[model samples]
Target: MTVRIVTDSSCDLSADDIERHRITVVPLTIRFGDREFVDGRDLPAERFYEMMANSDRLPSTAAPAPGAFETAFRELAAGGADAIVCVNLSFALSATGESAQAAARSLTGEVDVRVVDSGKVSAGLGLMVKAAATAAEGGHSATEIETQLAELKDRVLIYGVLDTLENLKKGGRIGAAQALLGSALSIKPCLDLTSGTVQEAGKQRTRGKARAWLAKKATEVGELEHLAVAHGAADDIDSFVAGLGDTPARHPTTVTLIGPVVGTHAGPGVIALAMVPAT
Candidate 1:
């Protein structure tokens, strides 16, 4: 069976990875005050960060409409795909998954469509999409790929060190991390997004210590199947990744700019690590 993979822009998969795997990405929309732009289409990550820094208010994100996913699924079916599996960011965080499911239901008889909520964002979602696409290329059925993602999502871990809690607080995604607000000035807040919720992991006295804690957390996870570092306009990303010091990974480390959708809430100077512990 010829299987195809689809995902939202939040995954942060590189252009090469998307093109190589023939994965379809439906874009979400970002609004800055009165203006709005498509995630990956009109808005580049650099430009988005520039706009965010200049604007007085935080940007907002909107999930794609069901018609968008429907259109993507139809195009893939026309391309002779026997089945299409869409992996999306967590339902708890956004309505993107619901939009995809609505689209899948609309295509009930015309083609086979399945959607998987990654329970992750950014690099964590990216890694899962890459794996699914690779499995599809190797002729795995939609059911098989879905099953693999079920196990993989649990092993996926996402840790972040935010430069500020202002973005999260303003965006109303602070959740349990709100406790850091009073002391937000004295420390760099570490975040845990592994459970699809923004929870407080810990805080460090300085940026260097916060990033070091991230690398240490990865090391403590033991063997890893995949590893990636994502940052939001962070200039020190290279040095941060270098500190990993020959960490073992089944795949080469992926360093990507956090896209506007995630960067909107993560704010600037955010550095995140995503990894999957080997079974």
Candidate 2:
């Protein structure tokens, strides 16, 4: 059966990447006071960050309705796709996974839709989506694609340094990284994706040191099969990516702007690194 790929906006894959891989993306909703904007559709990342920087209120996120996923599945099924593999952000972090599964169940005998919890967020999740898309485009069966995705999820690593803790503080909710508080603004916290939730990786006294440590953390994972440098409108990102040692001979690094979903909590000026271990 012909297979297609689907993912939520939180995966952090750009429009170009999605189109290039023929992947379907479902957007999450972002609420700013009285108004709400669709993650990637209505509010672009640049404008969202700009508003974030100027506003004192912390924006909230809501998972897409199950109907959204069902619509996407129905459309793709109508377009001649025999199956769809949907990879979403971690369930530990958001309800997007639950929404996807509900939609999958609703389409029971009609469309073959499989929802996968990446156990990751941001580009870490993006890597798996890309892997699934690549596998499907190569004629891999649905079963084969699912098996590859399961393996890839465990090998993914994500590291990020938030520019401010206010986003987390203002959001009034943090899973297990509560200890990140009680420190002054002088401390920059480095976080990693662990067991589906954001956790404190370490702390740096300055953005400069945090950047270096983030680069160093990537090397600890050994050679990478895929590596991406992501940021929230940070100008030093190019320079920061350059400091990440040397990319493996044939593997060039990918640079993408982090979208609204992940960018909301990571905040503006956040720089991140996501990679998959070499096979």
Q: For each predicted model, how many residue pairs clash, with residues at least 3 apart or on different chains?
A: 0, 0
Specify the highest-TM-score model's number: 1
Q: Give each model a TM-score.
A: 0.98, 0.96
Per-residue CA lDDT of candidate 1, range 2-112, in tens? 999999999988889899989899999999989999999999999999999999989999999999999999999999989999999988889999999999999999999
Instruction: Quantify all predictions' global Cα lDDT against the true fold.
Output: 0.94, 0.86
Candidate 1 ranges beyond 4 A from true positions: none
Candidate 2 per-residue lDDT, tens place, 1-279, comes to 899999999888878889999999999999889989998888998899888878878788888999999999999999999999999999888889899999999999998888988898888888889889989989998889989988888888888888888776666435667787867377988888746777888889998999888988878877788888889999798889878768562367888888888887777888988887788
Root-mean-square deviation of Cα positions for candidate 2 versus the true structure, in angstroms: 1.4
lDDT measured at residue 95 in model 2 versus the true structure, 0 to 100: 87
Question: Deviation in angstroms for 214 in model 1?
Answer: 0.8
Which number leads on lDDT?
1
RMSD of each: 0.9, 1.4
